[model samples]
Target: MAVASVTYLTRLAGYIALRNRTLSPRIVEVMEAAPGCVLISVIAPHFVSDRPADLAALAITLFAATRLPLLATVVIGVCAAGLP
Candidate 1:
């Protein structure tokens, strides 16, 4: 739990720092969207049996949250759960 918290904090800090860098608006938008996407992907069904899939999902979730739309994020999360 401690390690997980630390990792989360570190990722958040990095996210903030990246946001502060003032990239193009398009880039920023994408960045914002990435986390949501990744989160959805992470929780996707079939995520239980395959470690590789889990990692991929986690990466996607992180990526989507960085720039993905909030609505899309929620939808993806919901959809992921339903996936076989």
Candidate 2:
């Protein structure tokens, strides 16, 4: 698949580019924390919005997320948001 190929190629490129390099402790720490930062950046705004529907859906999603798999949590969020 195209997605798989792109993912593999990008990883290979990164490996080739970083070959024989020693990363500093700070750089390694940043790399480890980057995904959490990115995830928060994506989700933070949704949590702070003034809309009731948005808040309700996010709350339901957060609750479901604690007890369910990711796919089910996402589905619950989608269905909750679609409620009339």
Top of the candidates by TM-score: 2
- Candidate 2: residue 30 lDDT (0-100): 68
Highest-lDDT candidate: 2
The TM-scores, one per candidate, come to: 0.36, 0.57
* Model 1: residues with Cα > 4 Å off, grouped in runs: 1-11, 46-84
Q: Candidate 2: where is the Cα deviation over 4 Å?
A: 1-33
- How would you encode candidate 2's per-residue C-alpha lDDT over 1-67 as one tens digit per residue? 6645665565566557777899888876765565556566667899899999889998999999999
The Cα error of candidate 1 at residue 1, in Å, is 8.9
Model 1, CA-based lDDT: 0.62
